[model samples]
Target: MNEHDLRHLEIPLPFAPQRHSMSDRAQERVQIWAMRFGLLADDAAARRFESLGYARFSAYWCPTASFADMLLVAEWITLFFVFDDLQNQAITTGRLEDYDRLRHTALQVVYERGVTGPVPPVIAALSNLCTRTFPRNSVAWQRRFELNLELWLIGHARENSFRQAGRSPGPAEYPRLRRDASTVLPTVDLAEVIEHTELPDALYFGPSYQEIIATTADIMCLTNDLHSLAVEYDAEDTINMVTTLRDHRGMNLSEAVAEVRRLIDVRIADSQAAAQSITAEMDALHLPPRIRNGVRRCIRDCQSAMAGMELWDRTETVRFTPDEELGATRAIDYNNGFLDASELGRAAPADSRRV
Candidate 1:
């Protein structure tokens, strides 16, 4: 595969709906999970981001439940950044709101009923396990991404979208914009969320984890929608997650599911065609080879996990009277794991071994 395709695999083409940055707390959750996995010990990383108020305020966040997928999700997030820079544009608010709503609804449904993707086809509660388990760097990296997400909205919104690309107005304008953002997301306004995270002291990533997190997160979100083809079909009379849960668009679940599968097939083809794009970026940017390897591992792991959780299996379906499964909301009797994440441990390696 060439560099373009490699980059495409690392990143992705933005779809109709939009994507958002992982919150700082969500990043912290990852750190927490790593701690359990013996990933890291001290709070040095966390302390750096803590200073950036934006990183601290919202915390690192995700819409999936599977921790293993966070690697893909992070990649996906990074891809958006790439697109954002390339297009000389940020993301849109309509898309951000769409994903945000999906995240909130997923959290609630998972909490109350334990249903997973029923919230939104593209969204789920799987990543929460990662967030609840690990957390982002306190202020450094988390703050930058958090603001990037907000700025993305600034360019994409109807009223606030900026005509040109450049730095935001300034800190002075933040207070008022915060009030306006409150209108849409009362508690988590655009400015407020941007300002909440703590700033990083010095850019302090060890060898390389960026590609790992970004690539993994991207793969998970994309694949989830693909795997749920039947459930997402609007004409198949199956359960359509996005229509029913987020926008309340009446769609046939079975039909939507088939369509989603077809969509994924095409995405794979596109990735194949664009493999050179990745190597091109790497060569130009000169990212470390180890970072590329980490990215590869993430992709491989996600590929395996997706294959393992193949939703095609009958057992994965939601029965009208679905067999009793633990509801997401059901109280956890965390005997040993209530505090220590190590007890629950990370998901068994789900991705396939790379050829």
Candidate 2:
């Protein structure tokens, strides 16, 4: 699609966009936390990060989270974007070895819940996040989060391999890879953490719930691809859904975008169907009201996340601009003492510490 068409493209998400009352405060905290960990190199980098409006994105994604919980979610969003940009650079430069090592260190930090020695600032920041967030959830939830994260990391590796080989996955195989690479699964898991509700394993793993999650991933992924088409094309990235359709399905740019829009509508319908089916089943089984409500809330949150992503892309984020250059020259430095993993979860004076 051309620039004008892309700008005017309508993403028909069902949920109303909403933001938390503390989005500005949470944004400030995320900036300080990012600078403290050297995720932002200097004032320019800090300004670039702030312009992405990730804290607002997080607020929209988890509109009901408490201020403290919103802080955690915003931090996670910041880490995700920082890591994504770094990985993109690795892929662009064909530095697969570096990408693999970064992926390994990230997985290690998430799995171990702490760092044993000196590591890159990104890895150290992740370890601190894991330490603070993991202990708050059940073992089941933790395992699910870890698994989703591993899949996300592996998905990046797969994309890097594809890029290195100068080949795209067949359309049949692209969606699964795209879903994993989208990182929406773990984002959903974090939403659960923010909501302070965990679905029992049986319900969470059931066909209906899994379907809803999968469809939500598709919607979010395709919507992102739609909005980011111009930027990715400029970057010579061909893994996006729009590019996939044009390259593999014998469609033009306009045709490919139309097909993607159709697919997103279908996925939205499927998600709603799965949500209704699961809620009805819960009612029939006489599940506790709390359990049913929690399930409902989870589904609603997924919709909110979808809406938030589209809204952020259209109105808030500077990420799709060609000149944005996310993560450019942003080195990981850990000299700022706020990265101490031991101090992560502890309550301290506001100026001294913030998660």
Give per-candidate clash totals: 100, 0
lDDT tens digits, residues 1-355, model 2? 3843574366878877777888888888999988776677777777767787778788877788789988998898878877788777776665667667677767767776766455556766787788888878899999999999999999988887777776667778888999998888888888778777888788778889899889989998889888888777877786888777777888888888888889989998999889888976676567787777777777777888888888788777777755444545333332322223443333222221122
Report, for every candidate in turn, its global Cα lDDT versus the true structure.
0.30, 0.76
TM-score of 2: 0.89
lDDT for residue 209 in candidate 2, whole number 0-100:
87
Query: Lowest lDDT 10-mer window, candidate 2?
Result: 346-355
Show the colliding residue pairs in model 2: none
The model with the greatest TM-score is 2
Cα RMSD, each candidate: 19.0, 5.5
- Runs in model 1 with CA error above 4 Å? 1-140, 144-254, 273-276, 309-355
Q: If scored against the real structure, what TM-score would every candidate get? A: 0.31, 0.89
Best-fitting candidate, scored by lDDT: 2
Cα lDDT for residue 180, candidate 2: 90
